[model samples]
Target: MSKSTSLLAAVALVVTGGVALADDTKVGILMDITGPIASFIPPLQNAANLAVNQANEQGGLLDGKAIAVFGDTTGSAQGAVDAAGKLVNIENVPIIMGSLMSGTTIAAAEAVAIPAGVVQISPTATSPAITDIEDNDLMYRIVPSDNYQGEVLAKMVLEAGNKEVAVTYVNNDYGVGIGQTFIEAYKAAGGKITSAVKHEEKKDSYRSELATLSQAGGSALVVIAYAGDSGGKIVKQSIEGGLFTNFIGTDGLRDEALINDIGAEALATSFFSSPTSPADNPNQGTLHELYNAAYGEGADKAFVDQTYDATFLTLLAIQKAGSTDRAAMAAALRSVASAPGEKVGPGEWAKARKLLMDGKDIDYDGAGGSYDFDKNGDVSGYIGKFVVDGNSYKQTEVMQ
Candidate 1:
């Protein structure tokens, strides 16, 4: 071969290698699209897409490299692990945002993210154990943990003059964490837990369990379960059996579909605790308007905005690190979320972009509230107390 021809071939090979290397700056989303939590999952998925779209429209993250892939967890632990593996191995994405359920998030953190050194940010997983697990430096959650929500729910029950409370929780990390915390806090606050029952998910009937709880001598019953067909059936059966006069729930039971399934009457005299107020978030007006315009309805009260914020935060970290290297991005996340800098909210993407171009640091206070991540990747937010008003929930108080 001639020397000139061989040199041209080598240059062509370098150009091809450079293009492949540039394409490595991909981001992945793992969410629950079809499962028991399907109703709440769609809005979150939409919010994530919206954030990524907005990011790309504004010249994309890391100088227009752009995010590349998205996937679903199906609201299961094994499913989450599989999704994470695909994102890291197949899609070659270094950052992932998803797996809304606490159990699934924890499973993915341990089985996939921690070992692989990928940054996993969850928008709705509230279990304290996610942050408490040993060496979980890669796992971050956007919402407040169940530790605060459980305490808030316990206080609401006691303040309502209910001295005796019975508890029923689903058999999962989220359920058990909230239920145990509430029981401890309620007892510590001079209240009594008459009985606590843990029910397995996907069961056909909970009538016998309801009967057992009814005989527990409590005037009020608190349910810590996911909101969906299973929760709807349990509430309907409880009301029909006249097992309890009042009911309460954690954030999992805040789904609007629950009311549609069991009707307003079944939810009468019931109260629940949510992490934040969707209607009152100052940072979410534009997001809410956009979601309504796209979906032809308001976004659900689940952690959709938080999901959006989590995805954006991950991208911000990638920009700050100036690379898709997972370890560097994980280290940058803590600095970008905490104080000593300007706060960025949902509608301030343009501002964040400008600041990034100017080489300025940003601290994002998300739609869910302050994104002040501690060493454990947790933040503090208020718990909202809501009562059933016809078919909707009316916010009665804010528990801090």
Candidate 2:
């Protein structure tokens, strides 16, 4: 694990509210904690630990406490495989929650989780490619696929008067899935793309790509990349080179790091699209209250609600299964998460446990959304339109 990831994990474990037992049940946590999305991991790690700590405080997992064993997918494919191998083969966790990036999630699933017969749930792996994985119901994600977000973003861009734009995306599963989908939808909706470039991540500069993209004039630049990696660099270089003023970004680019790196004033005219919870769901308010009380801040961080919900639901699935039997997880998860049962919201582990003990069903309407998973283990969800709000971003509208 990287130094930052190790520090965050230590912080989460140290500040967690409960004491862990020797007979605790270990659950695997896979995340891109090192390379690109490092800035987004601390709050998400806190959310995961919150779920585990909440379960421990509320009478634990199957037979004892729930312990989170993390695996840092150094933001690469082989790194994901190695980390997942350690979780499944070494720690022997029955289930895993994580791998927020689409690339790492897919790689870990295809290479490790499926072969090991371990069920994995993701909070923010939004690639359209994940919808078609032949996992036999072992893989699940709480967020809507990038296919949905891509269509919504196309409409958002067009409606925002960006008739012409230059598109650039990182060359990875995350960027390719949303970038191509948005390109097709944008063109179909009569929007014009003056130029589009697929760039690699971790480069020191995007000046060459910006120069190429600037050769064709456009209204704004549509960047589909992580803010900590290629996206922030592209936006900064674009502004520095006077290539484009207005910018449009997807979820990967919608990090607080972006606003911090590129001043809020420069990004005032920029907008972003990301998976957001249903506005009408009161569970979100409950989660926010509990989260703020626990951590004192960061209740509104990207994917914090979804991460906590995923971890909590994973624990609930273990409880519903009554054992850590790998094959039984899928049915147990569906039974506890879908309808035809008593509704359970965030921070209600004890209630959910009692309901399961009494032979009752549960519908886990999470802080993110009601995760009534469809045939592909994908849920229909909301996408939010956001603009820079001081040091962070704020949702101005919810797009279904």
What TM-score fits each model? 0.89, 0.96
Worst 10 residues of 2 by lDDT: 9-18
Give the runs in model 2 whose Cα sits over 4 Å from its true position: 1-22
Predicted candidate 1 versus true structure: per-residue lDDT over 329-362, tens digit per residue: 7778887787666778775667787786687888
Candidate models: Cα lDDT each: 0.76, 0.90
Cα shift from native, residue 386, model 2 (Å)? 0.8
- Index of the highest-lDDT prediction: 2
Off by over 4 Å in 1: 1-24, 277-281, 293-296
Q: Pull out the clashing pairs in model 2.
A: none
lDDT of 2 by residue, 1-400 (tens): 4464477444312222345466667888888877788889988988898888889899988779988888888888998999899988887888999789999999999999999899999999999999999998999999999899999999999999999999999999999999999999999999999999999989998999999889988899999999989999999999988888899999998998998898999998999999999888899999889988988998999999899999998999999999888898889988888999999999999999999988999999999989988988898899999999999889999987
Candidate 1, residue 232: Cα displacement in angstroms equals 2.5
